[model samples]
Target: MNMSEWLVRTARRVPDAPALLSGENVAASYSEFAANAARIGGLLRTRHKVEPGDRVAIFMKNSTAYLELLYGVWFAGAVAVPINAKLHPREAAFIVEDSGSKVLFVSGAEELHSLLASTCTVHDIEAEPTFAAEGAAIAAPEPRAPDDLAWLFYTSGTTGKPKGVMLTNANLHAMTYAYFVDVDDVLAEDAAVYAAPLSHGAGLYNFMHVLRGSRHVVPLSGGFDAVELSALVPRLGNVTMFAAPTMISRWLTTARETGYSGEGLRTIVYGGGPMYQADIEAAVAHFGPRFVQIYGQGECPMTITSLSRSDIIDRAHPRWRERLASVGPAQSCVSVRVVDADGAEQPPSEIGEIVVSGAPVMKGYWNNPDATAQSIKDGWLWTGDIGTLDEDGYLTLRDRSKDVIISGGTNIYPREVEEALLMHPAVSEVSVIGRPNAQWGEEVVAVIVASTDRPPNPEELDAHCRSLIAGFKRPRAYFFETALPKNNYGKVLKTELRKNVSGL
Candidate 1:
């Protein structure tokens, strides 16, 4: 079944419900939203000659029209390839050419049409969507099989160029079901805010809200703005938004400085990067029980594991803090394991490569059979993350396999060191990386972002590390900075940082 069927079904049940919004104002009702998608589908099939099984790319920022184009692609049984609007034109063009997309719908980036060197026809979303609203309508969505491709997601390439992960209709169905079972539940009165990029995990969350006939809101700022959100929430009550850890920290800071209480915001599902304990602890203390955590990569598409709202706020349990530090148990649709290199499962409390097998795993990488075979062994997809599983089934991430630093034949995880350093009063943010040493092979080093009120003393930080973690795990040196560099997704660019290590 095509995923667009959910939109059609909801429109039939609740034609007058709010379906799309721009800030606090409603842009389209459920009936109008579904009709717009059908007309856009007609434009794809009749005007652009897009057919079933073809790929259509969307390089757009968050907008009310973005959802229309996405469902429009699905209505025609074509695959949707959404690229981050922040990506360079060359990088976005590479994805368009590699996917062999039939058409590219661009928003916000006007120069894309002129600069894009691909054969795919480029359409300005601001203009084409208007034509779609008036064009002939498709009678119904094109039929799609369970295993047919639905979404093509590209991985963040820290090491090399990115590869496209192929997600099928069945895989998306499983992920949506898991969201209701393991993540937060959506209501018709709730509105999902698009603060993060619509090209990644936040975009994948649209299905549940659409299925329940809820409002899909794109902020007036087009992206995360603390002032915009704090004011918008009151107009549209019972709001939920997917956010990264850095966004949560920023939200907390805004709340503290302005005394803006979290009154209308319902929940913020945080993931896509490590949420250090100190950051989450402060967020929970300020916002009460409004945060949930999920752990997954592009391969699994946000269905691997989840730390629920109840578990996050359960301070009554003796091991609550330990559980809080974990990514929580395996979600309903998947089996997670920590395994050795030889594909054997590691015992409890031993760190190893984390692997998963389930309904939500992708079909494979697009047009790369060899890479697909290398990643998925037998029946399991070997996630490149390094982590351990405890006796009660909770999984704790150590670091990425490549990020693990070996010093004098002993492995040192950066999270352990970084977690310790963050507990200091003056330590605002920190990232840990290994520096090459002839004597020790690699020595642990810390990059600190100190608070404006009190800059940390290196000697005091060393004592703080001594009190929390092992001596050898402590940083051998420190570099103070105003901020660490991050990728578009808010993950610390350790690879970029490693390039500057010798000078630092």
Candidate 2:
């Protein structure tokens, strides 16, 4: 059955059950959510003329309307493209244009509307009613074929342009099924709080919590608020939440300061990047051993390698704890291997590229055959992440092959900024690396070796970058040195650069 129909079934099963709660407003009852979705779907077709298979982009922060729009798009047999609201106007425009999205929905954000207006038809959600007049029950749009594209998720490209990862209906279903295997008991009575951006895989996958008949709650400001989370955690009983390492760190700090306790937290899943040992320990101490760690990519949504609560409690030895440093074992229906350049699997403890083969892997990159060929070879996805599989089959990530910088759960490619920086006449060499930040899991730091005797200040360099790239990609810190470290082959050793910046 099509995933959209699942909601209709759910509404029938539990009509009065709360499906979504956005701050003070609670969209209580699945019937309410289904009717709202159907109305929005009717509006898109009758008022906006949105056609089946057409791309509809949602450029908004996390909210109830955002969730409804996703279902509305699916109900209309259109593909939903959720863009990062934190992205710059140009960056946002690039995605809208790249996907050839026919209609853009903005959350009353003038900046987003103006940006997308140049490319596609823009619809403002705040100006429009949540639903239109009740129309005849439009037969749920035809069930999408397994291979039909459901979502177009853009990931950082090594070549300086973002590549849209085309996820099929089957891909999402496989992920949902895999998630259920890991957490078997997620039910309609539970509630999930969403703070992560729905644009990323982590945030979007958490929506499965809602699909299971749980209520979804968003923060008041539509972004991460530690102070707000501390209060909200108790308010929403038996709620599960997903957070990045940085977010968990902040919540832990806030909890300690105010003697906060997770009275209602059942599961706290953390992903997007590594959680430091200290942070993990602190989290376990405060929240008890109720944390779950997931590791995967957008291409293979939720093909999780999870560190369960049991594993966290049994911190056996320093070596065993080091295994905790790894991304954990593959989920059911997934096979993982560490392979060398020749695609030959490496033995345990040897670092190589992590390759995965499974039903959860994406069909291909949208409209990009060359990229698809490069990433997927013979049904296996070359993750482009350097990692090692342990004797027990757990995978430990070393580094990303592409210059993709993940900072605060957002992916940023260095080439995108480097190309922009090259425009400056005074710049000679530039390398952007993710430096450990207490708040942001990683913060962008650019190391530049200037050609001109008078070096540009960090603000000047930042301003130049800001003009070309998204705000998130702009460097948070700058360092000027004589030259970048390179090997005999003249290849810049990013390892050395990272070490220097890390002060190792």
Candidate 3:
């Protein structure tokens, strides 16, 4: 059950099927892709001495080569450890050392030679001699069991040091199946563009497309560029791309300037961070019924609830707005619940910690049993997200548990405050955080990115929030910036924001 087995199957079914693309041009066919993977797999076993359970890390950005190396490692029956390309060299090195990777593949080996003191062999994927030179292709991929570790994904260390989440072959198989049954369907004619970071959810989504022999597009920049996608999508018709909320916002801005109607764009599976109501509504109005929202974490690797295209565009339903704001019901394979601090199930409409138990949930954090036990209690992965579930089973996210502000003992979720601020005509993007106050404990403060040169004053935003939310929920202070600090996946760095606010 090595994940690369899917690539082999696609190659046999559609030898001539288009596989990888760079911009508008075809980079490899299905047969060619499989062949290259086999050869690379052979090289790993023969030359690099990678064993079945060994970890091989890929630290490169989005490219056809990245995918090739990823599958090649799996084909060799080794676990693929993908590092975020946006991380600092030191940070990437920590993951390499912690994962105990046998080899570290990178876009540039020279930069990491000094930073990484580990004995792991480093190879530049572009300059690897065996990628082009003579190498025996593996006749068949090494066998793997269902519980065998296929990927070791490290959580983004926004809170503390990253812990590797071990994802097994069975977990991935369930996630891929859930995509078709709950998420959007993929066609052989569809093209999946890698605009979001491949080390995250966007890369993990390659399974469904590969199973159907769909085309994969790696942007030349190896990252997001709305202008590039605006042109590329039309060139490659029937395109589907995973995006973060921030990327979607940038696309909306670019569409306004370029008048691009999202022609040839089939579906956008957006996740990785909280997508506010105002932003999602605006996207649907412009792009029509082409957006799907998924809510999951590194522990699950994108198999949670899915907000369907129909649910997103359904304006006629009596509860459409409320449903639209939700992440939809639990996906086919998982059981979701909202529970109180004492682990008791909360009634409908009561906010609590969201927990999930399913085939897709990670077995545990790699080499961190204590952390794993703390996170997954009684078989349910305690997703540190604060949310409420309605009677119909739709889950509405409030905010992260850490992001909740206890002002005068009244809990105020930042997402609620941000959503209210975004309702204002002048506000483009906003993040609300708690500023420590001596009297009231923690007071609400907003960090805003304005749409126009004339930013909304604190009084204007205060009045707008009052109409939409409770009096105490409105921000007591406002800080306007050109943009909010975000991670590679476009999640607002509230931890970083809080550090700055601590100074204020």
Best by lDDT: 1
Lowest summed lDDT window (length 10), candidate 3: 404-413
Q: What is the lDDT of every predicted structure here?
A: 0.86, 0.80, 0.86
lDDT score for candidate 1 against the true structure: 0.86
* TM-score to native of every candidate shown: 0.81, 0.95, 0.81
TM-score of 3: 0.81
CA RMSD per model (angstroms): 11.1, 2.1, 11.0
lDDT by residue (1-504, candidate 1, tens digit) is: 999999999999999999999998899999999999998899899888999999999998889989999999999999999987766565677788889999999965665666667678888866755768665888889999999999999764333355899999999999999999999999999999999888988899999999999999999999988878888887788999998776777778888988877888899998876676877898999988999999988899898999999999898988888889999999999999999999999999998999999999999999989889988998899988999998999999987765766554344668767877888878899998998764455689999899866787889998888765557778999998889999899999998777878556
Which prediction has more favorable TM-score, 1 or 2?
Answer: 2
Off by over 4 Å in 3: 129-132, 157-159, 403-504
Per-residue lDDT of model 2, residues 1-504, tens digit only: 455777888888888888878764686578887877777777778766778778898888788788878887888878889888887778888899989998888876677565554447787767865444543345565467877777888876889888889988888888888887764358766777888887775456644765777887877877788888788878888777778888889888988998887777888888887688888887888889778888888899867477766776676655677666877888886888899999999999999999999988988998999999999999899998998888888788888888677787777888888888878888999887878777887878888999899999988988888877777889888888999999999988888888988752
Between candidates 1 and 2, the lDDT winner: 1
Ranking by lDDT: 1, 3, 2
TM-score of 1: 0.81
Worst 10 residues of 1 by lDDT: 154-163
1 against 3, candidate with superior lDDT: 1
